[model samples]
Target: MSDTTTTSLLDAITVPAAEGRAIPDAATGETMGHAPVHDVEHLNRAVAAARAAQPAWAALGHAERSAILHRTADEIDAHAEELARIIAQEQGKPLNGPGARFEAGGCAAWIRNAADTALDPEVVFEAPGTRSELHYGPLGVVGAIGPWNWPAMIAIWQIAPALRMGNTVVSKPSEYTPLSVLAVAELMNRHLPEGVLTVVSGGRDVGEGIAAHPDIDKVMFTGSTKTGRAIVKSSAGNLARLTLEMGGNDPGIILPGTDVKAIAENLFWGVFINTGQTCAALKRLYVHDSQYEEVVRTLADMAASMPMGPGLDESSVLGPLSTKQQFDIVSSLVEDARSRGARIVTGGEAAPELGPHFYRATVVADIDDGARLVDEEQFGPAIPVIRYTDVDDAVARANASDQGLGASVWGSDVAEAVAVAQRIEAGTVWINQHGTLNPDVPFGGVKGSGYGMEFGREGLKAVSAPKVITV
Candidate 1:
C-alpha cells in the first residue's frame, strides 16, 4: 500500500484560479453558476494524486472498499432533492417530474449495485501436483471522462465500478455541464479518502491530458466519436485500457401490425427523453408503408400536446437543448431534410421565445434514407420517419448505420417482434421498448459506436486486470 496523505485546498485548485467558465441554465439560457476551468497541469496533478492513493485503496479488503462506496451512495441519496434541483438548472431536465430525480436515483442505485458486485477467485485446474486460480485485480488509477446528456448518472456509472474494483479515479465532466458532476465529486469526496476520487473540470486540453497521462492505467469515456478517436490516439502514450461509449444513430422500427395508440406515449418518451439528447434514443423510425401515415400523425399529435418550457416549470414536459451548438445541429439536420422534400408533420424550427436553444419536438415523414436526419444522429428532439414496404428491407436499412449502439422493433406480435429484433445489428436490441438499461445488464456498442461494455459483471472486469495464480 502506498503512503496516505491529507488533501488540502491546493489539491482542488484549477490551473487559472481566477478564470472560470459560466454555466448556462439549459431551459432559460441564463447564468446558473460558474465552474472553475482547469488546465493540463490541474489534470496532471489529479492523475498523480489518484495514482498515489490507488495502491492503498486497492490494498483494503473488497468488503471494506465496498462499505466506503455505499457510504458515498448514502451521502448522494441524502442530497437527492438538492442535487436534482441543481442538475435540472444546469442540464435542463425537468425537476419535479422524472428527469432529474430519475438521474439522481440512478446514481444511487448503480453505486450501491457496484458496491455489491464482486468477482470471486475461480479455480482453473485441479491435479495431484498442480493447481491454478484466476483473479480480477485493480489497474491502479482510472480516468473517467463524463458526458453532458445525463451528467450525474453517467459520472456515477464511470466512478462507481472503478472504485468498487479498488481503483482510485480522476474524473472530468463536460465543460458544458460540469456543476452537477462537481457537486457529485464534492459530496462524494467528503466520504472518500483524500486523493481517492478527484474531478478536474476543463475543456479539451484537460481531457487529452488525462488520456495521455502516464499514471492513469485505464480510461472510461462517454461522448462523441470524434473525441473518442482523439482519446484513443492520446492514450497510446501509455496504452491505457479504454471503455468508450460514443455516438449512436439508433433506429426504432414499427411493424405493420403494431398497435400505434397503445405504444404512442411510451414511444414518444422513448425518442424524446432528455430532449432527445440521449445517445441511444430512437433517432430514426422505420414504419411499414401501411402504417406510415398513422404513425407519423399519432406521433405528431402526441408531441404537440406536450408542453415545452423551462425545466423548473412543473407544467413543461420538454426543455431546451443544453447548448446553442446542439440546437444548431438539430436545426440544420431538420432544415436539410425539409429542403429535400421531406414533409414536416409537426415541428421543424427553433423556439427562440422559450430560450435561445429551445427546439420543438419534431416529426418528419415522406423522407427517404438519403436525408441527413434519417442517416445521421440528430441527438436532439427531432426524429425522421421513413416508409418501408418489406420487413426484410426495413431490417436491412435499420442496420445500415456505421453506428450499432442500440436498436428497437415494435409490433403487436410478440414472437415476430423478438425475431425481428434478432436481425437488427446493434449491441442492445429492444422489443416493443427502447433504451431501457439496468445495472445488471451489459450495454455497449459495435463498429463506429465505440467499444467496451459499461454495466454488469463485464463492466466490472473492464476496470480490472486478470491474473493467474499457480500452486
Candidate 2:
C-alpha cells in the first residue's frame, strides 16, 4: 500500500517485452510503454484458466467475495495517484478535472458499491401449499471488453459486479489504453485468487475471441455501436449473454428563460470532459430561440478560457484526443459542419502547438439537426448548438436520434425541466446537469446505444444468473 509497493506493482506489469505493441502517450506522440499483443489462442487460455478457477470462486459465496472486493477497493485507494498517472500518460485525460484522477477514484467507488449492494434471494409468491423464491448465481466466467475513453473505470464497472455475483472475469482492455487496465487488474489480482481474473491486453482478435469463446458465459462490452454489432455477431456462435454499452450522441436542451451563466460551467464540462471522448457526453445542444444566443456565447467564453494542453500539465483541464483515428473523426465532422455554413462561435482549429492529437475545444452555433457534427457522435471536444422555437419540436428532434444513451434538460423551473427530461429518449435524463453518474444509479442505454444496465443492484444482476426455487 506504500508508494514503493505501488511502484513495484506497476513495474511488474510494465516490464519491457521483447515483442509487444508500443503504446504512445496521448499528450505527446512519444512511446510510453508496451503491452503484450495477445491473440485468439491467448484468449482461449485465459478463458480456460478463468473457467477452471470460477467454481472455487463461486464456492466462496457472496459474503466472502464481497469482503475481498472491499479489500480490493482499499488497494485502489492506496494506488489511486499512481493509477491516475498511468491513465493520464496512456489515455490522455488530464490529471486534473474529471480526468485521470477522477477515473481512478471512480474505480474504487464502484467496487465498494458492488460489494455493499445486497442481492439476497427474494420471495416472489406464497400460496397455501407452495412458495417461490428467486435467487441469483454466478454465470461462471464473464468476458469484459472495455473502451479507451475510461479504460480503468469501465473495466471495474464490468469486473466488480461479476466478481461480487460470484463469477470469475477475463477482461480485454481497449488496444489504445491497455496499460491502465493492466495496472488496475494487477492491483485487483492481489486480492483475487489466481486465474479468477485475467487481463488479456490485445487487439480486435482477442476481443472477437472473448465474445465467441464457448467457456465465457457472459460478455460485457462498452464501445462503438459498429463494434457492438460485430460483437453481437461474434457472440452468436456461443450465445454468450452480452451487455453492450455503445456509442451515444446525447442531446442537451436549454429551455427559454433559463439563466445561461448559472449553468454554463456544468454544461461546458458535460460536453468537454475527458476532452469529450466519453460515450455519454453531451454531443449536441438544442436551445430555445430566446436563450440560444446567450447559451452559445456563454459556453464559447467558458471553453475559450479553459486551458487545453498535455495531460501532465497541472493547469490543463482538457487534453488531446486519445487516438489519431478519433482525432480525424472529430476534425472531419467539424469540417463538414463548417462547410455547411454553421457559425463557429469558438475553437474551430486544432492546437498543433500542444500536441499531434490535440484538437481545440470547439463550439459551433447556427447549426441544424442535419449537420454531421450535430447528427454523428463526434466523440471529441466539439459541440453543435441548434436553435429551436417549439418545445415539442425540440423534444421530437432529441428523440429522433437512433442513439439514446443519456440526455439533459436545463431550465429555471425544476418541474418543467423534469417534464422535458421525461420525454427525452435516453436511458438516463438529467435536469440542469449532464453526464454525471453515481455508482448507486443504474446506467445503460436504449436503441442503438446498446442494451443491459450497469451500476447499483441491477448491475449486480446483469452479471448474474437468475434461478427460481419453488416449494
Instruction: Tell me how far the alpha carbon of residue 73 in candidate 1 is from the true structure, in angstroms, after superposition.
Output: 1.1
Model 1 segments more than 4 A misplaced: 1-19, 125-129
**Residue-wise C-alpha lDDT for candidate 2, range 1-471, written one tens digit per residue:** 225543665575664667788889998989888888888888888888999999999999888998999999998899899899889999999999898999999999999999999989999999999999999999989999999999999999999999999899999999999999998998888889999999998889899888888888999999999999999999998989999999799999999999888888889888998889999899999999988888888889888988988888889899999999999999999999899999998998889999999998899998998888988999999999999999999999999899999999999999999988888899999888899999889999999999999999899889989999999
Note each model's CA RMSD in angstroms.
3.8, 1.6
Candidate 1 lDDT, tens digit per residue, 180-247? 89877876886888899998988988898889998899999999999999999999989999999997
RMSD of candidate 2 to the truth, in angstroms, is 1.6
lDDT for model 1, please: 0.88
User: For every model shown, what is its TM-score relative to the native structure?
Assistant: 0.95, 0.98
The CA lDDT of each predicted structure is 0.88, 0.91
Clashing pairs in 1: none
> What is candidate 2's local distance difference test score?
0.91
